[model samples]
Target chain A: MSDRKNLNRAVSVARGYDPYTSEWLEHEFESYALLREHLPVARTEQLAYRRQFNGGWLLTRYDDISACLSDTDVFSSQSSDYPQRPWIPQAIDPPSHTAYRRIMNKWFTPEAMTAMEPHLWDFAGELLDKMLQKDEFDFVADFADPFPTVIFCELFGFPLDDYEQLMDWKNTLMHATDGHSAGRALAVAKAKELGLQTPDEGELPSEVAGQVYGATAAALYEYFGGLLEQRREHARNDMISQLIASEYDGERPLTNEELLDTLFLMFMAGLDTVASAMGLIVKTFAEQPDKRREFIALMDDSQKLTLAVEELVRTHAIVLLPRRVTEEKEFEGASMHAGDQVMCPTMAGNRDPEQFENPDEIIYDRVPNRHMGFGHGPHRCLGIHLARRELRIGLQLLHQRMPDYELHPDKKPELFGGMKGASSLWLRKG
Target chain B: MRVEIIADKCQGHGMCNMVCPSVFKHDEDGFGYVVAELAEVPAELQDEVRLAEVQCPERAIVIED
Candidate 1:
């Protein structure tokens, strides 16, 4: 069916593609065709987690998503989190944000990605071998989850033993459904039990949700804040240590809080994104055996393999970033006012027919794939290089070891509300 | 074929490098530039160069024949 029809259906459909709605739960991108056609700048007062104020327009069209992302002045990425606090470069607007990004840019450059490949290849093999040893295992719990987390720990010089704790902290704070963390109480079961509907912008059951988020966030800060101080005294060859010694504004070193904030942003951006991408990649390849074979045939050629990964990234695009309107403005016939949170669905944008020749279908070796999977403009994903590296090597290793892997008989992917990913991907190796 | 990239418009998407490596290369900052000293596309790689021109999100890559 035409996505436009689905989009119109959303109007009468309960939970109409609301991030927390049952309609969205059924499928996130199913209604975007309608959204892009009719509601390029549609406004609503309902949201899943953040209900501070009535919502602004949700930009679903390809051009609109790009316009909002690139227009730094009108659509600012400044801290939209309630009880406003700095979130490093992400929270800061440009000129200043450019400087902070510059400091961290060198850490994730193409050169750095190349340098880390050998290490990543060995590690991916190590993890895949371990998984292959097991006849059947939850791909996520077995490899998809811990693989990136462990790599994250090694990259930042965080204590290796604390990887589990770090994952717990991250999953709890980032992944939530009802009033509890999906990591702890389990989001799917909670969703089923509560059948939670998307609350109006100001109608969120915030008291409990706020406390849960606040408690989790505080614990993460306390843990990482101590690590920053320790790094200051005993610096090492890790990104965390690099951040600690780096200077900004002038010769003044970054404050402990800035360092902590920056690290927090990196944690949220890096680990879950890669892991989620891997789970989907593995799951998709497993289901489409012929497509998997086509991808494997290109595995020996680095250039083609890289292009395949880009196409896969486009097909399974994740992340729904929200930007706040800086002032009253007219954009593509949609009027936006200051302080309105504009939800930009990059995942939907990636599938826009105007951009890709066959946007909905995954085309391996899709040349010139200008996908917004990493987003656009200055605030574009700082970890793009590193993420691409992880996906490339991770998939390469998976196909090499378990060429015939497929999803377990009874299990399907567990997709979250806002972010699209496979939380539970059960696999059986051939 | 001659080529040029509007660096300001280039968000460093890196599609140019993927499409025609011999024609374009991303600098240290991850932005793209014509790799040939003359900023000219070789005839042998002309097809690939056109491919990148289409792929660039910013439409930063331009080709003149």
Candidate 2:
């Protein structure tokens, strides 16, 4: 592969292998496979490569990706220290990460998430009912986006009315770095259009964009603060109240900053990741009706739900875990510097042929499944249990309620952002 | 038997204290830092300790027999 000097040869081969260039995000899957096939880790001198975005190291091999995640000390989660509102805690490394994570862990446990099953099911059911009422609806807007957003709102004890506004803010925030000037400009415009004003807007004119960008932060902080105050007076039976009442290290109460940051992280991370995954899962099932029927059949058998959920996560890993090298190290013969960023694309890792048989195909009952869909080691997704519970309950309810659903032929599914997942997947219910 | 926890891995999910409250306790960080090591394992609490092992989401605890 190295002897072939023509780079276009590889690109041409990739295009032939995956014909859906128009619809796919970055032709990422094809390129990932090509890179893995050619060299497990290959360097690209592409001008589009930005240092901040994974620092140009894309670990395409499964073992290499897994090794990076496990070695958290050497490979830090502090991918960038740029001053921006931290909407996700997974971006932070240990020590400080420890405290913030503790406050939020209560909300994401299997037990906590299991309790949310009924609510999530109801959310899915209600959304599906609305969709079934219409002849055709945008799957991303009507179902995929709303399902996770509503769940997140409920989890944070926020009003359901704020779902649309929250979704728009999150979308803008995630794609901010792609086109810095344009993205920031769009964010400011959105804030104005939404009639949302930030608290810091009055004090610091220089940081108006920062303030505007962090308006959601202010809103969240105020919301959580009110709940915390209420909980301090008298604890409610909700996750917010539980967090407010939680004692860190033992006797120390969480600071207001810690509480708000943790809540914001959960809200932001939960929205796109789960929604995108759900969209892809539904799209995958729609594309393969046989697999859809098989999944439905498994749903009928109570014992198979866990296996089905595992397979779904494995098959459609949307979020790529990004890590930075905290120490100079040699990994798989590559000399990684202390500041270099490594993007562990879970989708690529999960689909490595060396790890699983027929890596691309969705085997609904593949046992001994150890995919990094929820990630690995300590920094693994805290909300994974909730994500699984939500997915399992949502899918089960969806299959049971609308077993004969099919994708609308007229509408093409939009892949969300640069992430390897669907944004919208329109389906017609029978 | 006593259990030692790597503090860094602990997220203070409270599975340890919830399972074996007599053995494990939360520290200043809201995480379960080791409290005490029991000399003789009470038969009743053995299941509780095992429950802690399974329930700990972080997998930060290791038990010494």
Candidate 3:
């Protein structure tokens, strides 16, 4: 087949670009390469109908994605109306985004993260002790999922007892389509609240998934709403209470709706991304022993470990940031219309050849590594410092417990897309 | 070289602080700011300061020679 034909085959959105499938995951890098070379801004007929918006342009190069993210006025994060409730700071543009960010930033600073390190280390050790007891286990389910989720709960002041429930709700909201079977039962239960009676037996329709997400989200809002009331009465030294004590633009207290919106955003963002990153990182290590050894070597050295974390995150970049073009204009030979959805998949940008030398390879000490795994610009990940701390502690403890881990020969990692990670990563220690 | 962070442009990615903690420190809100004690980028720390300037995703860091 001609290179162009192969490129077309790889980049065709109509071919059902299901990220859950190994085929799609395998083609992803090749497709990114082809798109960057021949069509940096390629239009898609559909973008996984499961996504909030479909049929838009995909920006596959580093500079273009960076430009799109940096130029927030033109490429707005207020992209979709799907969720209906806007995630504060994430969905809100400028002035408002700034104000919202300010209200929450202090709780996630490097100093706060540093203060939380000993607790994190203890927690990681606790989890690893339990995990290493089993000869073989699903890393995503066993360690990765609970590690970040539990830490986030502790930070947000959610009862540690509710951690399992919180994880189920999150999975229902975010991983329903990714074959997370645990989410299915919870989705059905939540679906009842939405008056949705058993959404068939097999694959949930996109509409049903939307309804389930809404129902799950409402549960979270109510959960946090109650928590907010308690914090209002008597503030605790936790993020929720801190947010309650915060002022918006120094003018007034944040509205209940605003607080809920922000918490909702935090709930989703805090629980999933770090866990997803851990899953991806470990899965990579399981498949590639040499990379694992290199990473293990850096575990004791904080400086080298920091650089290693950046590179692993860069290579396994999961976010596919969507933006709405605010005005019609020509951009890099593509005629973009106002309100058109544009996807800036950070994976493509992180792996763009023009930006990084040997873009696909994970060089633990890649200098000047300005990869946007946590994103860029005003809406960058609020919990970045916490995330870095988590990765460092998580990896350090994991390798210390099981230095010779590998992918289970019988079971394979189920790669998920749309804020990508393995839904299930089976591993065995040698 | 004197270094400063343009507070308006900083969204608190903290790359400046990460790359050069000697010159850059984060506020309680994680926003990067040059250390008040450091009136100038010390000769020893200039290279790290330059890297911080380059690494600031928001381009909020500035150095005047």
Candidate 4:
């Protein structure tokens, strides 16, 4: 097949050869390199119901992605763009987004991180100890999955007993093989993966996926809503209580929908991203012993460890958000229409050669590194304090407990292309 | 040298604190704040402060001599 044909096959939004599949997922950066060099803003029709569903322009360059994120006016994040309900501050923009952020910002403040540091350390230590006690362990199931999940649940006041199942719901909705399962469930998931903000009712997300995701969403809403009301009645020193009690501009406070949507966004965001990061980072260490040693050397060095966390995140940014053009506009040499889906491939931006020296390398102390791992602009990650602290403490505890470790000799970790993460990673301690 | 972090642009990316802790410290919100005693970057830490200025993702930190 021609290079163009191969790239097309790899970039397909709808079917057979999507980025998440082996055709593109395994060679993601190589394909992204091609896309960046030849077609910075390549457009692709989503495979499923191409007629009814709209395709989008994939923004691959670092500057373009950064510009679009910063240019909120032309590229809207309003909930209307999504087929489903809005995710509070993530789906809102400007004054309103800023205001919503201010309320949650208190929960992620530096002091909050400082207070949570010991707990994060404890979580990391406990997980690492269990993994280290044995010579063989599945890092993904054992550590990556629970560390962030537990911290997120604890900070937000979710019942600790439900951690495993909440994570299962997240995995089911996100990481299932494309188009492989029951109707609506698979379609909603695939449509989501394809960055299809709005899918025609009959086009995809068969009735089952809708019901499945709907049930999951409703269950989650009730879960958080119950907590919000509880907190409303009896406040606690947790994030949910703060959010429930949050008020601004005397606008009669946030409605229940607003709180639920915000919690929904938090619920989804907090569960998977960090686990993905840990999976990818651990997978790399398993493969690259040298980098692992280098990382271990910096375990006690706060400055170096902090910088290393940023660099690792840059090397392996896991989240890719979808934005729709508000109106007709010319962006990065592409003429796009209103209501067009534009995927901001943050990970691709992190690897853009124009943005970083040795862009593909894991330079532990790369300085002046302005990578968009946590994203950029007004809607940048609100949970960065917690994310950073988790990364640092997680790695510190693991390396201290199992300094010399590698991938299980018999089994290799499974990785996905989109929002990359290991399905399972087997590690062996020395 | 005077060092101040512009609140509008700062997204609490802690680069300033990492680069020059003496001159810059993270506030309760996790955003870098100019340390009161060291706002005027001491001669020894001036270079570090400049590096922080260049490295700040939002370019939030400004060191004015």
Alpha carbon lDDT of each predicted model: 0.74, 0.66, 0.81, 0.75
Which digits, one per residue and each the tens of the lDDT, describe model 2 over residues A42-85?
44323113333433466778788878887879988867543344
Please, what are the lDDT tens digits per residue for candidate 4 over residues A1-430? 6878866654553233245432456676876777787678778665212223355777778888888888888887761323257887899888788788877776786556778888888778878777777889889889998899998998888888887667656665555443212323444664476455545443343444444556666666777777888888999877888777778544667788888888888887888888889899989998999999999998798878878998999998987766777889998668988877777778889999998888999998888788888888888888887888888888888888778888899987767555667767898886
**Candidate 2 clashes between residue pairs 3 or more apart in a chain or in different chains:** A248-B28, A248-B29, A248-B30, A249-B27, A249-B28, A249-B29, A249-B30, A250-B27, A250-B30
Per-candidate interface DockQ score = 0.45, 0.08, 0.59, 0.54
* Per-prediction TM-score: 0.90, 0.75, 0.92, 0.88
Ranking by DockQ: 3, 4, 1, 2
TM-score of chain A of each: 0.90, 0.82, 0.93, 0.88
Q: Is candidate 2 or candidate 4 better by TM-score?
A: 4
Instruction: Please give, for residues B1-65, the per-residue lDDT of candidate 1 as tens digits.
Output: 79999977887767777667777876766777887664776678888778888777677888888
Residue B57, model 1: lDDT of: 69
Q: Candidate 2 local accuracy as lDDT?
A: 0.66
Better of 1 and 4 by TM-score: 1
Best by TM-score: 3
Model 3 - which docking category? Answer: medium
User: Could you give candidate 2's per-residue lDDT for residues B1-65 as a string of tens digits?
Assistant: 55577777765555466446676776543556665545245666776566566546456777777
Better of 1 and 4 by lDDT: 4
Ranking by lDDT: 3, 4, 1, 2
Kindly report which residue stretches of model 2 are placed more than 4 angstroms away from their true locations once superposed.
A1-26, A44-55, A81-88, A175-188, A191-235, B1-65
**Candidates in order: C-alpha RMSD to true structure:** 4.3, 7.9, 2.6, 4.9
User: DockQ score for model 3, please?
Assistant: 0.59
Tens digit of per-residue lDDT, candidate 1, span A196-227: 54343322354544555666677678888888
When 3 and 4 are scored with DockQ, the better candidate is 3
